[model samples]
Target: MLQWKEFEAWVCIEGEETVEYDVQTSEDDRTVTCWIASELGKKFSIHWKNKAFLQDVGGSVKVDGNPCGGTISYAWRDLGRTISKSGIADAATLKSFVFSSLEVTDDDDALISSSSSALQDLGLLELTIYPVRINGELESTVFSRLNLSDLKVHERSKKAVTQQIKLAEPQPLEKAPRVLDIERTGPEVVKFCFKYRPIDVLRANGIAPSPSRLKRKASAEPPRALTPDDLEELADLEEAKNLREKLRALEKKLHKRDKKPRIKDEDGDVIDLTQNGARNKRVKVESDRPFISGEVIDLT
Candidate 1:
């Protein structure tokens, strides 16, 4: 989250809070920048909140240099969102944020400057918030839909990003009223930018970790104490692991013992020649039991 005084903002993908890396804030604390991973076909949203609403505040959102809409809230408000898409007052459609891959082209002429202007701000989701005061009553106005396909350019212009915002299936949005007369109350404005790239690109740039790497999140709560039952269960599990180790060791020994060869000698005794440590190992066999010429006997 990007926070300035009581105002804060962040981006959410499919209702999930993504990991933000390389977070940097200006010395004046008015501007913040961070990196996030964007997967293709995933939907995302921008959210902002103000804890201490002492004055009327307004915000504007832009995705990939495309201005979505301006949000004007009444005094002493808490939360708001960037208008991704809008419809006429009588229509029933809303806009959603989706990550989409750019279609590459092989046009040599357009490759040089095809997407220069578009890709410059292609991966940025910026929000600007500032104090505002209005003079006239609010009027209802509809947002114009933006067609992304019409902005296609050569793939070389994509820079470090290959994906752009893709609108999902139309959803419903709350009715909004536009402020007719509004002016900034302060000279300074707070800005937050969420820069995105593909997951592999982020990992290669050391902005994100490799897949399935060991990771831990920071938690405010302390570790919980272990109960007596929990300790007992842990002890039992350890004992079981030790027993399995011992059983494996014994089985290994038995297998080695069975692999040795043994045979009876000329006398009524069993001679074991498999033992390399001993010069000649002999076992006493029953004199009454007659042994065959090639009969084998175990001395171990």
Candidate 2:
């Protein structure tokens, strides 16, 4: 028994709504064949019958509400009809089907025809048979039919449809310079290796040191010796010190004498302090004579 399964229907009816039919033959031998019939007045009548003799056909039929009489016919051996029956026998057997037809007018002279015997070899002729049938009887009818040429089975292992995406290698991080773990010391300890005699020699001589190194060394070691010329210069300084002391004593004596009381006459004579007590007391004298101890005085 011929098996029909996997049926699919695609129908395009011009000026009419598309209709789909899914029919499956029962596995029981008693329900092996069936007929689907539709009648819409005198305009159209479609009859589909399935028998044990015709089992490889399955497709959809579109009846025009105003079909031209005798403009279309169905051949029992047509691949479309065979596939239509096969599709109805088993819903799982049919793969795909399309039925399309175009109307033609008497005034139009250009007619398109497509002969596709190649589609019949590959089972695709079922899709083209209906359009060709209607095109045969109508004027100015145009029909286009497509046939399968190559059946290519892709090997999934050959290559992936999309290349395997690879993440870019992470950029190597820059390495930081290795820092030495040095221990810090105090400023005095840090100066341990520094030369100290230069500064010490300058301080001993009571001379300020310049930032540049000295060209000549006055003394390389401590406790610098004094030459005879240096001793003579020291003696001169001692003598000058003595003179300054004597001068300071004289200035003290002069200050003490000026602090004492003194008397002076109009003629600028020094007065004796013991006799007249002029130094201790203020006295008025007559202008005619100045007397000392009751003696008459004469004008000079």
Candidate 3:
């Protein structure tokens, strides 16, 4: 039902969610990378080539990683995802992923420096937007694509779909942010380099880092509230809800009876399975449906 190609021409997303997010930032806070995932799970990363500039009230200059403060050549590429929509046969193409500009704040900066627990809060990452559109008309906001069929509309009508993404609040690493001492490539510019430690260099005597916060919490009794894992599993089951319903219908079609089964031997001798000692020397017998062969076999 999604008219992705038509919507791509005019659909523009201008939003931001604080990360423990995509739009990767370096430890030194010089280079920042931003990324967003579409509803279908396609990833688009924004590369800000230039540091954002801030002019103080006294006319002094401060350089930061905020993309909104400056203009620079930025582009994004689609990182394809494997999405399984119940009724959608073909995968949706990601036409474009664009951020209007970056919005940075002191609080965001502080969040970047705190513990990594912020990464687990999905509500903090996603927005509940209303006034959704369906074929140019505003419709109710339903989060899952499976619910789209519930909307009252003609089958021939074109469907409008919105991509959903949740950005996390970025939290800083606990250890001192390791920054390379390489010469600056340009004013306020830093290049990212991969650094790896050899296993030999690892301190065998040192304790390994603690398990993640969620893991630590999972060791205790789970809360009564539905968790993110539960919601994800539920979403998967929701996609198969129709199949389950069909299976139930088929089961209902099967003829059922509470009486004991009647078995026939090769000699056409009728045997009451419920009678005493029927299990003695009973060879494997060919079986058929009760309605098809008019043989009422009670399984009760």
Candidate 4:
């Protein structure tokens, strides 16, 4: 929002995006002029003057070959008197002692400039200049008793309503059930398991009850312990005994290699024992010695 003290009046001429003018007034009832040019080589002239109070004053303006209407008014105060014009509503007020207006002019090649002079002198003070555009034309008029207080009252009422709404409390939201609170007793679990399987079809397919199937049948039972002869037979199996011994030896060899093994090959290749070395050492080979013949290397 912009402050009122900083506000300046603006005019949109023929819906143009650029090209705006600032309006100013002279302290005394003297002629003031401004010139503007359009892109099409057409020009305009604006003129204004100060008046004593709410009274009628006339000036002349020419747009191309067309004539425009103009007027002026004034407002008096202790500091100075305010002078205004209705061509573009540019107004200014200052001390009576320092008031002057010289012949104003602009020489932009494409712009048209016209002279504005007061037709008659009047004793009016405190004036507002209003310029009306009728049918794409400008006409000037003076106004009295203009007040903007109603706008301020409406704004205050809106702000109060907005503050009241903001101070009100918000409503609570509904909550959803928690996962752990859902019931899961024994019978419910059994029923859920039954829902997952077709009981009649499973029985027809020779699937016995879980408890009965878990129990061992006497005739098909395995021996509880090995007999003496069975133990001796296991001991006599030389391949099994050799495998056990080889596994124990491998365990011991790996332990020793981990602690202190050669880190390089005979050819100076860096031996990575943790990865590549283990895989490379697992290659099978048939030894000529009968004692170590058909031995399988277990790198893992």
Best by lDDT: 1
Residues 1-300 of candidate 1: C-alpha lDDT, one tens digit per residue: 777777777778888777788889895767989999888988888877766666777777778878766566555444442322221221345667788886667686657464465667778888888888877754444344443433565766666678777677776656543435678999546898899998789989888777656556568899999999999999999999999999999999999878766666557555556657335554444555777799885444
Question: What are the clashing pairs of model 1?
Answer: 98-166
Candidate 4 at residue 32, lDDT?
22
lDDT tens digits, residue span 69-179, model 2: 111112455423322211111111211222221222333232212232221121111121111212122222211121112222123221211111111222332442111
Q: Candidate 2, 118: how far from true, in Å?
A: 76
Residues 194-226 of candidate 4 have per-residue lDDT tens digits of: 000122323344432444675886686676898
**Candidate 1: lDDT over CA atoms?**
0.70
How good is model 2 by TM-score?
0.18
User: Order the candidates by lDDT, highest first — what do you get?
Assistant: 1, 2, 3, 4
Error of 4 at 94 (Å): 39
Error of 1 at 65 (Å): 0.3
Off by over 4 Å in 4: 1-11, 15-29, 35-37, 41-53, 65-300
> lDDT values of the candidates?
0.70, 0.29, 0.28, 0.27
Clashes of each: 1, 19, 12, 12
- Compute each candidate's TM-score over C-alphas: 0.61, 0.18, 0.15, 0.15
Off by over 4 Å in 1: 79-91, 112-115, 137-142, 145-149, 173-181, 212-300
Query: How far is 182's C-alpha from truth in model 3 (Å)?
Result: 28
How many backbone overlaps does candidate 4 show?
12
Poorest stretch of ten by lDDT in candidate 4: 188-197
Superpose all Cα atoms of candidate 2 onto the true structure and report the RMSD in Å to 1 decimal: 49.8
